[model samples]
Target: MYVGEMGIDRPRELPWQELVLGGTAVAVLLGLHLLPDSGGVDPVYELLSEYPLRSVVVGVPYTLALLSANTAVVLLGVAMVRQGLLRGWLTTTLLAVWCLSLLGLTVFLKDPVGSAGTWYGTAHKLCTVANFVSLPALCALLWRRFRTVSGWRGNARRVGVLAALSMVCAVPFAAAFLRYGGQLRATGTVLGLIERCIVVLDIATIVTLAAWSRAMAAARDKRRFDHEVI
Candidate 1:
């Protein structure tokens, strides 16, 4: 049943504590993305190229980390939504896609081609774009849809603002992807400043989502308190 009919109120977002922690985790991942790797092609991939790690040691541990972290964040987002939070789905989905993207990166990292430059480069480039640049776009779309689904009236203007921010944030990475992606420099598909800008957008989006979740929770709590007093 809809909370509106049940006398249960939904908050505008989740609690502040949740928002801070969740936002911080997202930021750490973002930092990992921004961290310069060997100052060239992904260091993880580069090292794997020289010597593949034992499946037991590297592969299993990495996979577990990716899956566990991603799942935890997704559940946290869901919990927020369950308590009348909004934007939780998008946040959950964003974290999931990102974690999956990292998991996807693990594949390329372990099997980077040493002899064939162009072919391996292309594959890695595509994965980077898909995971790094495009995933944010997916997240943004989800956030917009989530807001609409929240059934919050007169939120068109707010949604519009979010849409605009997403587009603006996308510009840098999009350009970087097109420019340095194919270049066979030492960097090998490593994007420059533009990519960093896209990451910044991702960071902003994460924070915004967290805030939105917190607001939803607060609103719900307030409504419930008011009813008990009356």
Candidate 2:
């Protein structure tokens, strides 16, 4: 992949994408939650929240601490993108940039050059909206890669399909479940628990898969050595 005409080689960037998305979603939720005791999330309140979402609302700075923190995380993703996978990484990186830029609008809200208020909110919403598009881009890449993988894994076809679909929906659905989850959930903590579980479970699964693959390769080597000695 080329960033400003520089070539970058990244490997297994799906994990990176997951990390960044999870971070951004969590940051936004936490930021809003920490604000002085707001009643249960209401549409009218949400609308009002957006009204003052600029950098200089009432001549005071907005709470951009979390948003800026997310931008730093996004930059790390960009920096790390130079390692084997392309299709998933490329699409994900693009979506991430867009999302970060939307959030960035707030940091510049008061500046003469910066966009603020509803415009920034609209852009932020737009970037979040584009997340659905990112899903398809990643799915296509995974589907193509799946087609190429040597059928070494049992049920290769099924695994490929599932991976492609799971990755695509992971971010977007999680966002929806998070934003509106309180209403549908019996307890507000359910979504939080679910998010934590998903993060831990997914990371553990990927690490386990990597370890298993290495073990298989080692076994293959040992068998070859035995045959050669015999």
Question: Which numbered prediction scores highest in lDDT against the true structure?
Answer: 1
Q: After superposition, how far is residue 150 of candidate 1 from its true place, in Å?
A: 11
Best by TM-score: 1
TM-score of each: 0.50, 0.37
For residues 78-114, write the lDDT of model 2, one tens digit per residue.
Answer: 4334322223557556546534644543443311213
lDDT tens string, model 1, 182-220?
332345443344344554555555455545555566666
Clashes found in each candidate (C-alpha, N, C closer than 3 A): 14, 5
Indicate the residue-level lDDT of 117 in model 2.
Answer: 38
